[model samples]
Structures are given as C-alpha cells and as structure tokens.
Target: MDLLSDSALMLKVKSGDNHTLGLLYERYKKRLFGFFFQMCKDASLCEDLVQNVFIRVLKYKHTYTEESNFLSWIFKIARNVYYDHFKAAAKNKASDVDELYDLKSSDNVEKEMEQNEKMMLLKKAISKLPDDKKEIILLSKIKGLKHKEIGEVINCSEGNARTRVHRALNDLKDIYLTLEKR
Candidate 1:
C-alpha cells in the first residue's frame, strides 16, 4: 500500500510476498538505472546491471532486516554487482553513441551545442576518475544522496563521506580541465 514504508515493503518481500518486490522495483528502477548510467557508458550493460541488482535483492531476500535502511541495503547490493561487472569488463572498454543523460534545451541553438560539447567532455573526465571516486560522484551528484546516506552506501562516517565527495569533485574538475585542454 502507499502508506507502507520501504522497509515494511522489503519485510513483506522477505516474508515470501514475492509480488511486493515489484513495488520496490517500480519505486527504485529509474534511480538504479541512473546510477548505473553514470557509472557505465554502455546503455545495454546499464540495463543488465539494473536487472542484476533486483535479481540480487530477490536472491538474498532472506537476509533483509527491519532495522536496515532499504535504500542503502539495495545500493550495497548494486555496488557489488557493479564491481563484479567492472572487474569482468575491465579489459573491454567501449562506448556507444547514445547520450548517457538528457541535456536541457534552450532557445539558442549555439548555446545548446556548446553545452552538449561541454557535457561530453565532462563525461570523458568522469570516465578518467578511479572507480571509487567515480562512484562517490555519481552517488552524491547524480543520485542526490546526502552525506549520511552516502556514508551508509560506502560504509563510512558522514564526515568521511563529505570529505570523499569533496575530494571526488575536485579530482573530477582536474580531470575535466586536463581533457578540455587536449
């Protein structure tokens, strides 16, 4: 029901109410996809990763606990899935033509093109970052998780999470500038 909290819904899922997971899936599917999209350049692979996260949630449903934050729990599983895929695909980096995220449009065509170019450069810069920093940036910026939530995802204190986000942003900016210069 609409009033059921995510934890309650997940508890239902853990209790063998298999259909309840679909509700969780609906609630989180887009955010999950967005997370994967920023982490990965391949659209199809991103889709697969989203499916894998749910598959993991279902496979490991018995472990769900009432005290656990459902969003953090699911993201931990998703992070693992991403790491597994990342290791497996480390040697085969390839890019596709599809835009990773949507670009805002304005009335001025020249500005739009310039903005598109800048975004592409930024994506390239993001790709150059180490995996952990990249994940932090995506979680903080793209996913809009607060420092405390990010700490939960990365298993650190909130202050540490804030520092990591700050460091990651600085690193990203450096990479973006270097790429832009070339």
Candidate 2:
C-alpha cells in the first residue's frame, strides 16, 4: 500500500490510532531536528525539542484541521515549543548560552582550522542577530520555507515577510563581513 499523506496520517492519529503518530514522528523527526539544531546548535537539546514537538502533536491532534497545511501547522507547534523552552529556561536561569560547533580533525590541519574559524565566525554573526531577524533567516534560508509559509508562521503578510527576509539577509551579510574582518 502507498504511504498516506501527512494529513491523512494525522487524521488517523486524531481518531485515536496512536500508532499513526509514530509514523508522523518518523516522517518529521529529521526535519524538526534540523530546524531545532540550527536554531540552538545543541544536539541533546534538539533531541528533546523534537520529542516535545511530537508530544505536542499528539496532545493537540484534535486542533489540527484538514484545510491547514500540515508542515506549517507542525512548524507553528515547533516554534511554540522553542519559545516555551526559551521562556522556561530564562525563568530558571539568568542566561542561556550555546556552545560553538565542534570541528572534525583532518589531514589538512591548516585548511581545517581556517574552515572551522569561518564557521565559528558565521555562527557568532548569526547569534548576534535580533530574535526576529534570526528567526526569519532560520525559517526562510535554513529551513527552506517559502515567503508565504514564513508569513503564516510569523503572522505577517507575504510581502512583509519577503521584505523582512531581505533586510535580515543584508544585516547578516554586514555582520558576517564585520566578523570576518576581525
């Protein structure tokens, strides 16, 4: 038999077939993990957030509508999960710091070092972005979301989303250049 659509599987999940929820998890796990990892750069935390997203999916399956785009709906949940985590962590602690990415060892040590330096600079630049700008970049550039979809998630018009993404890119470019020059 053919694989069911995400909405179909989700409907199954809504109807009390919990097994279908597993199928939905399997389908979205990688993408959701990538989204979370790019935002926070923490493997362990990303794993937790991805689990939480699936949990929320099961928890709120009844709220999902057939007319809505499944990907957008799930991403909305993912965004809320992230904000909830952020807020909770903020309340528990004064600061939330993310560690830099680890670089792999290679035979060309100089090249590896230079590449790692560039990656570190890029990540730092991205980290410095205001939350709104960073989120737009992650959703549009990193997650490969369309302007319309991004607008839906961010609660803006499509044109506004496009404009915000453009400005964010320009800001990121400036920041990256400044960091590179150091």
Distance from true location, Cα of 150 in model 2, Å: 1.4
- Clash total of candidate 1: 0
TM-score of 1: 0.82
Candidate 1 weakest lDDT stretch, 10 residues: 92-101
Best by lDDT: 1
Best by TM-score: 1
Candidate no. 2 TM-score = 0.82
Itemize residue pairs with steric clashes in candidate 1.
Answer: none
Question: In model 2, what is the error at residue 106, expressed in angstroms?
Answer: 7.6
- Across 57-125, the per-residue lDDT of candidate 2 in tens digits comes to 989988988886788788889999988998887532222323455556667788788887788777778
Per-residue lDDT of 10 in model 1: 94
Lowest summed lDDT across 10 adjacent residues in model 2 is found at 91-100
